[model samples]
Target: MFCFSCCMPQDNVNQEPSTKPYQDTKPLASIANLSLKTDSTRQRYVAEEIEKLGKNNISADIFTFHDLSVATNNFDADNLVGEGGFGRVYKGRINIQGKDEDVAVKQLDRNGFQGNREFLVEVMMLSLLHHQNLVNLVGYCSEGDQRILVYEYMINGSLEDHLLNTSPEKKGLTWDVRMKIAHGAARGLEYLHETASPPVIYRDFKSSNILLDANFNPKLSDFGLAKIGPVGERPHVSTRVMGTYGYCAPEYASTGQLTTKSDVYSFGVVFLEMITGRRVIDNARPSQEHNLIEWAQPLFKDKKKFHTMADPLLEGNYPEKSLYQALAIAAMCLQEDAASRPLISDVVTALEFLSPQPGDP
Candidate 1:
């Protein structure tokens, strides 16, 4: 078999550090005030962080705010990707030393509480882990206080970009694309929950956060809210509740006890999004239908009613067995008792099974 991806494996590529004619090394965003200590230890720590991130199939580069500003044309709206609780994500590119290739950059707000930690977590986790289903983080910049995380450009944007606003009349994502995206995103989350050292708990999972590439493959992003699960015998991490509404697991939301299952619950919500093409919470919807989780919870078991929850774009072409299997997996994930929810590994297994295989559906 031949591996055709343009990228080939390398043991560790030290991202070509700047040896340029310019000197203004600051983030292009607002995080321009961080007073980095000159100690070799601090530099080593940041360097190690970058190397660790690079090992997981992510390329790495450290750009100052000056470089990013030049790339984004000063945060022009045309370069914007999207916005959320953190800040607007701008699309830009930076050329690191030696590579002679430009890479996509994600610039976050300097002052946003969600910027720093999320920047580092995304840097640390995404760089160390590799999977076909997960997105790749190319590199990041934390010059001064201006933090910017970079990833390979994902075109077609996010699942949210297509599902909710996409026209049902035309230009809609096909049923096949949606299922593949769901399965891929689930696999990414599964890798985070089960494969990383010390095991990471992805507190957030939603359509808007799942980015898509040119082929419509989904990549999970935004790890600022991630929590490192206990390494020993502890079953969960007790933290202040953090996550977008509607997707938070019922038990984790109520009790603040988080485990991999908590993420399973969130993955279920994403699955529901794949099936229904609606935001987890939408006020414009009728009051009766505004509450997505509550409304969909019951129908998950009633196979006869499954079609009602499906996205209209699907035009009723989904496989009954696949849809039912997906629904059943989601039902277990959303179980009120956290213990009842399946592990992320199990969730991925179920999703993989439901997806189209080598043969016919």
Candidate 2:
């Protein structure tokens, strides 16, 4: 249910303001510095686009600011689940279809990296794209300068919460759980790359963006950075480099020539993280191991060293055959040459075999 991505730089994480909720629906002062002309233009654009979408009949509900305020108990501190450069996500409850249900309310910061355009883009993207592995958008609140998104509350929080920062009392994800997560996440990417109209390029694929339900089912979240894949004869979508630091593909980082393979490379990094239980970029580790891909590139070349790359926390619990096979999939995705990387569909097919069968246990 959380919207704050843990993949951001530590310094960029803003402390939530302790101010009381506003009694009226007025724009926040944070956006005051923006020229009225600029703000008007932006709002006009979003309004026009929304009008167009209304003509086509989008399914997402348009929630009022007052309704969401009451839902989140005036954005109570206790309900805050996650926060990042984008904004804070709060756990709330609202009546849907006449029954009360839990939801995650993501309130975007007026001065944050996510602007009006990103907010509209997210609302549009989630409204159009539906998949089991994609987080469900219940509605959004775009009153004044306030930009908020309401989504189906995932009880388990983000995968990063369990995988990279699990508390001492909590157990790490088991081998079976990891494979299941990888397979489900891969299917989500496969759907985006293969099934969606015009195909979607999940430009910001990373571990922190993957949320988990009570059963540990993974759902991809935060589509603000998502873009339409190249159409027709075009092979790549040219855009400014804008993904998380460690997860961006080398070619895209340098050239800004984005393609579906860029997302595959990012997926490779996340898969490697899940397998090894290490941050993609950890300065605490030795200089040689600071960069996960660099450290694993050599090991990927030698099947004999694959065991060494496994998460120490796994304690040799994974099957030797599965570990090698999983590493092979990761290796192919991490290929420096984008053309060499397996299509997301192919990756999904490879991971499908790694999941345990019904009678295996």
- Give the winner by TM-score: 2
Q: Which lDDT value does model 1 have at 332?
A: 73
Model 2 C-alpha lDDT per residue in residues 1-361, reported as the tens digit of each score: 1111221123332212122221221111212323343654776656666666656666777888999989999999999999977889999999988999999999988774346756777877787778889999898887777789999999999889889987778889999999989988888888788777577899999888999999988999999888887879999989889989989999999999999999999999999999999999999999999999898888887767889988887899999978987888888888889998888877776676677645676
RMSD of 2: 10.8
Error of 2 at 67 (Å): 0.7
Can you tell me which runs of candidate 1 are displaced by over 4 Å?
Answer: 1-59, 96-103, 168-170, 358-361
**Against the unseen true structure, what C-alpha lDDT does each candidate score?**
0.68, 0.81
What overall lDDT, based on C-alpha atoms, would model 1 receive against the true structure? Answer: 0.68
Estimate, for each residue in 1-361, the C-alpha lDDT of model 1 and write its tens digit: 1111111123322212111121121111111211253333343444445554445444466667787888778889988767776667777766656554434567666664455546766665555556666666666776765677767778778888788767646477777787778877877776666656566788988888888888887888777677777658887888789898888987788889888888888888888877888788989999988988888877865768877877877788888766666667667767787777677666655555555544665
TM-score for all models, in order of appearance: 0.80, 0.88
